[model samples]
Target: MSNLEIITESRFTTVFIIKMLYAFMCGAHLDSIINEIRELEKPSKNYKRMKPATKFIKQPLEGLWHKHYEQVGLKSMAMNIKQQMGLNNKQQKIFNNTFFKEFCDIFNNSEIPQDKRIEALGYLCSGKQYIDRINDGKLTGEWIIYHHCNGKNYYLNVGNHSDGDDALAQEIREIALFEFPFFKGSLPIFD
Candidate 1:
């Protein structure tokens, strides 16, 4: 075996004889050589550090949804949607749950960057029917207005075909332009 190859020996035996000799020739202490070997054996900081798979956090909007839709009975986007789509409490819950899950799936994926998560979610929500079986193709005409603030996604409104697609699209643009004017991601086209 090469002098650099580690030999299987008793615990007390010298593991690095070649290293020791080299150290001795260089006027370095055995302890210093051992420390050098230990350092070499230690894993690098880069190797030890691993990025978390998901940094996507879902803020609960159930209370907000209830407050905005149930308490006031105002003619907001969600209300319009609820009325037009005739979504009961159970159907609403299912929509919220499924949408949240799909959001999590996209955001938690480490492959997608923080800036792009919202865009990806927009694409999915616009195209995919998450709770199709229950909502009778609800997502087909869904409009979700969201604000990405400090890495947190705040879903502001949920509209549908009943609310008028142009109105919903314009609402999103106005919110992005006026409310979150400093937003990073370009406005995602839902057409």
Candidate 2:
């Protein structure tokens, strides 16, 4: 059978789909997806030792562990798919660009709902909270971003540096790039 068929096949495909969905929802790339799946798989062993209330509880936990491992397996499978389909260069670029552009646009437009805009902006500003909020569609609005003409100007006029500095800002930008590298040309680059 074809690779696409394998990705669509229910049993194997669900894991692949979940991994991709997780990656997309978390604003991560394939590498991050691989890392997350690896992390998920590692947690399964710890879960194995835990005593469940009953067989029903244990079975679900076991099923969850299996699913986690399956996602890890799918990460390898995804690599194969990336190579086989030439997704590494062409398709990857297209997907990244489209995803980021859409994500950023959703944030910039006030016409978008306040909660969603806050959530998108939160993702741009804070990675940890972003991931948590992604699936739930909740907005924390705790992080902030500022623009400045110069170092002194940024420090003095923008806001408190204690909240986050240029270095942190740079990190956020880097993470954004990781999620959507192809979007370099499309996004407004601030100095």
Candidate 3:
């Protein structure tokens, strides 16, 4: 097997290894999750928000869909798409750098089935359809039920939004607040 395949197969083990390395670098014990948390909490000016366009673009259906794929943890599936479509290195890098790590993290946390995860990722990566689904109010509530191109329903929930900066923006932001944790603590202003 290729190195990448081996690495992918041993994700849990790799996570453990990464934790061990982190602990060793910081002179800490392996059994202490709190220690890791404490170390992470130390203020660092290097932190920066992921750019929305770089992370979640507003145009080109493919770009948007890819972001959704990353959000839901389906890089392998996304990679398959890249291979099948003969994506160039630049495109591959975009998916690899931006969403691959995030996908791994989400996969580790979520208990959703693989097929369902793939379906959701597909919806997310399909930019035009994803926007349509969101704008059509199909992505609201505690769970999102997306109707795929083939007419099958796939269920998942990013969260709900209740307010925004304006009537419409506030409503959109409210939904975002619930569905996306990054927006949870943010203030919603209507003008």
Who wins the lDDT comparison?
1
Window of ten residues with lowest summed lDDT in model 3: 60-69
- Candidate 2's residue-wise lDDT over 66-143, tens digit each? 111111244434433333323357766885676577667877798988997888766544453233333332321111
For model 3, state the Cα shift of residue 161 in Å: 44
Those runs of model 2 whose alpha carbons end farther than 4 Å from true positions after fitting are 1-87, 120-191
lDDT of 1 by residue, 1-191 (tens): 53123311111112124323543564444443333223233434442111111221323221111001111122332433444334588877876877788889998999888779888876555434322322432212222334434544434334433655455445444444443445434334321
Q: Which of candidates 1 and 2 is the stronger one according to lDDT?
A: 1
Q: How many backbone clashes does candidate 1 have?
A: 0
List candidate 1 stretches off by more than 4 Å: 1-86, 127-191
TM-score of each model, in listed order = 0.24, 0.21, 0.18
Error of model 2, residue 104, in angstroms: 2.5
Better of 2 and 3 by TM-score: 2
lDDT of each: 0.38, 0.35, 0.31
The TM-score, computed over Cα atoms with residue i paired to residue i, of candidate 1 is 0.24
lDDT of 3 by residue, 13-111 (tens): 233344334434644333232221222234234422111111112311111111011112244234433443344788668756656665565465568
Clashes of 3: 19
